[model samples]
Target: MEHQSENKDMNHEFLPMTSVANNTGDQVAPGVFVLTTKIVNVYFIQCSEDPSTYYLVDAGMPKSGDMICEWAEKWFNHPPKAILLTHGHFDHVGAVNDLAEKWQVPVFAHHEEIPYLNGQKDYPKPDPSVNGGLVTKLSPMFPNHGIDLGSRIQPLPEDGTVPGLAGWKWIHTPGHTPGHVSFFRENDRVLIAGDAFITVKQESLYQVMTQKQELNGPPKYFTTDWKLAEKSVQTLAALEPSVAATGHGIPMNGSKLKEGLPHLAQNFNELAVPDHGKYVD
Candidate 1:
């Protein structure tokens, strides 16, 4: 397939943000690897039944396409068969267009997210009025525009099967975005949680820069519907995932996840939802 064009925002300037984990990668599961690009994460998952098969989940920050490709080549020794998106957020899909064209592979996303990926709609604007710290204060600078993926983007299979990665299902974990989804491998209970629930206090600059490991809701500035976001967190927490790698912050598991996830779910309104924000009801 000829990818004759680029995403409209491919040239967007990189945001001035970094964490201690930037450019670092770690194995969160037998075949699941997480790479931090600036402050966001993109995953490389290897199929359980096939050692040579792998897929990229979520493209990282803007201008990080080459970095992601290099990491993939070094570790997997081959390009992925497909790229799976948890959502169409700017940070998550930043390198998607370039990566798809370079690898000549398909990009799969939830059907609800197709409009944003196809350039038909823009996400709700970020609300800096949300309660938080420097990161939240700087929210308005983050891009909320959608990029055109043209023919390379396709809706994921309705059956929940992830295209190239076997033994996993995509869960509709919206609220962070209307179409936001999380990947779960039932057998091991490993979750690629997108921004449904992250490990860092994304709205706090210090927490973000230091990569503090704390269970928190989606970035408050970008989350439009607290009700749905709350429901989404409840959904994932009930799954009792043994391990989870989110869009930001470090991969969290064991006691932290066990205690924190439930706590966050049980007290979402008090904890995750901002008391007031432009998007908050």
Candidate 2:
């Protein structure tokens, strides 16, 4: 199945963001794959031996569930054993309820994110006033309410163990969301950096549309705590990921990742954080 066209009937209104996105369906490593949604991304962690036993990194935009499943079938000819989340945002969890039900798999997220994922809490409103561009301006209308995933959702293992994938650990990268996380594999230095950091300049309509590759912090409008966010970037950069893909923008690696990561972590105040926003101190 082809990716669905952009989701326009949502309660939230993002005028310019399209429904279909550039599917960066490429093999980053021997067992890792990346797939793009309208303006976000999801990952497929395939098992070399067991097609039925694998993992999904994050869920994508509202109506992109079929695209995700198709991407899985294309790569491994089967479904995943579980759905792991980085946080509970509309863009990231939009397709979660559907996919988790379809695959009959548990949805795992950081313990802190349970409130938002279980209909117990709502995220603070996005600061559209933050300096970025149209996307930032429209951010206020974006959905901040929690989804009711019911019994299908659970917290990631407290021991940092990833359920279906070996050698991967979930890092507590808060600030984007109280429970945001990024995945890492020390042996290969492969990082699946959720929104704790992203590769696109999310504030700009132009750059986000073009999928420009840049090392930017979490999307400015939605990020609530700058200090913790900065610390998270420093944490991921210290890992020195050889190849990295994020929630937004395209995949990046080599010198760009090597040089860009440290630079972003060191200079996030000026390079990534905005000057003014409700959450900004």
**Top lDDT: which candidate number?**
1
Go through the candidates in order and give each one's C-alpha lDDT: 0.87, 0.83
lDDT of 2 at 122: 96
Clashes of 2: 1
By summed lDDT, which 10 consecutive residues of candidate 2 come out lowest?
7-16
Candidate 1: tens digits of C-alpha lDDT, residues 72-102? 8777777898999999989999999999999
TM-score for candidate 1, please give it.
Answer: 0.92
Q: Which numbered prediction scores highest in TM-score against the true structure?
A: 1
* Per-model TM against the reference: 0.92, 0.90
How far residue 56's Cα lies from its native spot in candidate 1, in Å, is 0.4
| Candidate 2: pairs in clash | 6-19
Q: Which stretches of candidate 1 lie over 4 Å from their true place?
A: 1-22
What's the lDDT for candidate 1? 0.87
